[model samples]
Target: MYSAFKIGKKFLHYYFTAANGKGHGVHSPFVFDLITKVLNDTTNHPAYTEVEEQRRLLLQNETVLTVEDFGAGSTKGLTKQRVVKQIAATSLKPKKYAQLLFRLVNYFQPKQILELGTSLGITTAYLAKANTNAVVTTMEGSAAIAAVAQEQFDALQLKNVNADTGNFDETLPELISKPESAFDFVFIDGNHRKEPTLRYFEQLLAKAINDTVFVFDDIHWSAEMEEAWEELKQHPQVTLTIDLFFIGLVFLRKEQKEREHFVIRF
Candidate 1:
């Protein structure tokens, strides 16, 4: 993980260089629509408050659990024991980006959704709520964390989610081989290292359709992650790429004969 000062510097550079959130001079009709309809949508969604309320409650909880570090460890340093508040603080996606994900699902209405990480299920709830008809399969590495996420799902009454537990390496291949593995939308947030990140992307590629969209979290987290992001962009199947600083979105739309990449401010 990069130091706070380094992350701050990168953010400053990104902020100044990326295109504004507004459609402005962006010429691609599809991207323009995304900027106007999804990225810039201003409606105050109810899920914002609902999921945020769960985040608020978790922030105050002092319950501790034994954890297993499977991926790139936490920024605060890894430990076997951790408090719920500490996990929530370190792991949960910020409400802003989580709500953006909600809006994306709400807009695209992907029938089959796959989320590689379900840290406390805050983001999972947002995804499941966006399209009630969609089936969300969310995976978590730790059993204790997965249990807490299930509790959150029950609290939200999100019946569409199917939580899977275990290391992604052991769990993902089986999930991908299933008959219904043709995922319409995938959110990759589990392991942050380059090899695991690329491995998951390549494995998931087998089930990807032209319309399938893949979102990678912490694209600029480190040098290796940035390398993975660049290699993904250069792949022949990736027709379009969107860089939102913290997260990167990949598109494999067949209609786009020419590839394009955009760094958009969010």
Candidate 2:
């Protein structure tokens, strides 16, 4: 993960170099539609308040759990025990981006969704609530954390989600190999290291279809993550790539004539 100063510098560079959030000069019809309809959409769904209220309760909770670090450890360093509120504060995605994910899934309406992380299930709630018809499979490493996330899902009545708790290396491959595991939408947030991130992408490629969309979180979190993002952009199967500073979206649309990459301000 990047330091505060480094992250600030990168944001400045991204803000200046990236395209405007509005669909102004974007020429690609698909990307233009995304910018206009999904990325920039401001409609506040009822789920937003409901999910955020759960987050508030989590922030005030003082329970501590034993955590297992399977990926690159946190920037602040990892420990055997961590507070629920601290994990909620640092690990969970903010409401802005989480809601944007909800809108993206709500608009695209992917039937099968896979999430690589389930930290407290806040983002999972957003994804599951977005499309009641879509089935969401979320993976988490720690049993204790996964329990908390499952409780959150139960409280929200998000029946569409299935939380799988284990090391991603052990759980992801098994899930992907299943006969019914054809994911049209995937969120890669479990591991932050370069090799693991790229490995997950490659594994997911076998399950992808022409219209599958994969979103990677914390793309610019570190130099290695940026390297991984660049390598993913060059992948032959990926038709289009969108960089939104904090997240990177990859599209595998067979209708595209040529591969293109866009950095859009969000």
- Identify the leading candidate in terms of lDDT: 2
Over 144-212, each residue of candidate 2 has an lDDT whose tens digit, in order, gives 999999889989998899889988888988988898789899999999999999999999998988888
Task: Give Cα-based local distance difference scores for all models.
Answer: 0.91, 0.92
lDDT of 1 by residue, 51-79 (tens): 89899999998999988768885542244
| Structural similarity to truth (TM-score) of each candidate | 0.97, 0.97
- Residue pairs in clash, model 2: none
- Model 1: residues >4 Å from true position, as ranges? 74-79
